[model samples]
Target: MQNSILLTGATGFVGGAILNRLHHEKKHSVVAVIRGDSHLQMQNVPTVRIGTFDSDTQWKENLVGSDVIIHSAARVHVMNDTEANPLAAFRKVNVEGTLNLARQAAASGVRRFIFISSIKVNGEGTTLGTAYNADDAPAPVDPYGISKMEAEQGLRKLAEETTMEVVIIRPVLVYGPGVKANFLSMMRWLNKGIPLPFGAIYNSRSLVALDNLVDLVLTCINHPAAANQTFLVSDGEDLSTTELLSKMANALHKPARLIPVPCWVLQGGAALLGKNGLSQRLCGSLRVDITKTRNLLGWTPPVSVDEALAATALHFQEHQ
Candidate 1:
């Protein structure tokens, strides 16, 4: 069945992908909430521009008859530091803004609220071989993660109090076309033919393709099994750092320039500079188990990591 959907973060990566998919499928009436003027890609879609997150604007009125609410907006990283009170900034939008909209949604009779949360809510770094599942407790390590974790908690509590069904999806390291930040940085390194010293690092981490994530979001929007559940989703397969770079090279149609460098030596260098913390994230193994998601929702990621990498490479090539 088709329904009107209220979506936030329409200008963002994941949100934009879902919007495109919805348009292509002709599934629903989309009301996009953007902070500013709609991007060229979103200009044709109906939108409500509100500069402030806490504004009790008439946007809620649009949600009166909406079937689902997908909250995707969050203050992503501008840099790698806790320069100011990051938790405060994250809360201003992630926590408070979320509740403000959710409360209004429930009041307006929206049935389901789908939250796009990060896996960082589980923890910052990872343990080798072991992977985090849906049953694990949240132990957010950073300000951003803490804000998301708090939002999840608050939303769950609100769901218990109201008729709104809240579905939380935690995705890890989503990468695809038009991706920026760490993903783009890695692409740059590969494109430039830079020889990486991570050949010996064998750490497996789960990743989700943009298309696969979009598929999951669409399913959660209306699936009966998705109501009031927290699901950890991924591509189902994990990839080592060396294997990932190799796949990337293949996608770019370039030769791998990977060199074997012991993990201990890299850690030693980072320790000297007091940046051992970063080394953990860069070379750490962070895998997610999506068994529960499949069993419950009867869903799986649609794209393989290889296909995702190929698509990303083609996109970058066109842009370049």
Candidate 2:
């Protein structure tokens, strides 16, 4: 049976990549829900324009008859959020908006709803050698994460009340072409051969490639075991700050000019500069254990960390 898939965030980074892949594969009929005016011209794929995500917006028309709804759209973390109430702003979209959509989807008889969430839902960072798994209690630390946690709770409740299956995925740092924010900044710095103070930092962090994440999403779209399940996804390989920088440098064909600065010194410097969060990210150990995803779903990340990094570097270079 050809499943009609309703995809939100089709214009954004991860969603765009998934849209392109689905379009290229031609296995399923796709209806992309985008915001505002769209000039996206793609053959065989229909587009729906929803002005904004809120209580008043109607989604039943676009949601009806869809077999699966891949909801990738959410108010992501803003480094310096300017909103008067950041949590309220996030809740409006990530929580309330998500529940609204899920309600519509359930009423419309949509079979599955896949929600893309963040690992911050697990917490900021982890202890060395300790990895977070799907069973870990949610410890959302920020507004964005709190909103996602609320959305997940709402979705699960909706699932219990209705037949629409809800699959929640909390993915660690996702990197690929068209990536932005801190990952993009790191790539640019590596490309320019900037010396970093993370050489001695031995903190392991897990990351998922865009392709790997999309692959998992596609798997969950049809997999029976994925129904009403929550997952933590990563590349299955972990890397330290220095190791990651070195790998990125290799991908960029540049020398890893890293100075060995103690983790304490880095933390102190970042605190002095009012960049404590940034320092934690640079020096913290946050790993994900994908044993459950592997054993339960029978899925694996197809792209290696090296391959993904190289592709990202190449794309960055070409775009530059």
Candidate 3:
């Protein structure tokens, strides 16, 4: 049974990976939705061009004969957001735009809608001994997290009102071959053998490999238990800042040049530099318990962290 899947953010990291996975699996028919023209070539997959995604963006013409909707596109969280009314700006795209698409998908008789949400919806950070689960009450702190929380709320309401099965997946920091931002930056610093101040940081954090996340998305597509379920996903292993850096260095065949600076000193420096949030990321603990995800979906991350890190390092080396 081939399901016609309408995929948004097809040009993005997660969505593009999903598209490639679907293509290799040779199972489903995919329709890649892009905000503009793309040069991405696929054998039989077709592309749908649309304008800015918003409350009023027309999706009817593109929704025809679509069985599933994978909504992975959103206004990502950034450093030092300068947008006035950041929440409103995020809502216009994440909440309003997402709900708008879900509303239209329901009306158009789309069977399932897979939403890629963030773990920030849980909260900023947790202690090393505790972990966030799907049933935990949401405590979004930032505009992006708040928007995603609102979007999830709206989607749950729409699912109850309609027959569309909604699957919400909250993933921790994602990393893989084409990862960018902080993860990539850390890799670059490691490759150059730069001394980092994360040696004394014992904070535990969870991560999901790109392949693992894509596998989970594919699982939720046809799984009956996935309907109306919110799942927290990770690699099922937590790593401290020092452990992570060493692993990255090992993958890159570089020496881990980490200095054991006191955590207090780093926090104090961050405070002076107005990088408190950055400091928290480098020093705070954030973990997600994916027990429910595995029990319900009968799935586990197939890619080991070491394997994924090696692939990421190889890609970085080739490109550099």
Task: Report the number of clashing residue pairs per model.
Answer: 0, 0, 0
lDDT of 2 by residue, 1-320 (tens): 56999999998888898899999988898999889886455666799989898767798788767999999998889889999999999999999999999999999999999999899899999999799989899999999999999999999999999999999999999999879999899988888888888899888999999999999999998899999999989999999999999999999999999999999999999999999999999999999999989988999999999999999999999999
TM-score ranking, high to low: 3, 2, 1
Q: Which candidate, 2 or 3, would have the higher lDDT against the true structure? A: 3
Report clash pairs, candidate 2: none
TM-score of 2: 0.98
- Model 2 accuracy (lDDT, Cα): 0.92
Which stretches in model 1 have alpha-carbon errors above 4 Å?
38-40, 55-58, 81-83
lDDT of 1 by residue, 1-320 (tens): 78889888988999988888887788788888788665637457888777788524445566868888999888875556665788888888888888888888888889999999999899865688799998799989878899899899999999999999999999998899999887888888999999998899888888999999889999998889999999998999898888999999999998889999988888888889888666786688889999999999999788998999999999988998
Error of 3 at 23 (Å): 1.4
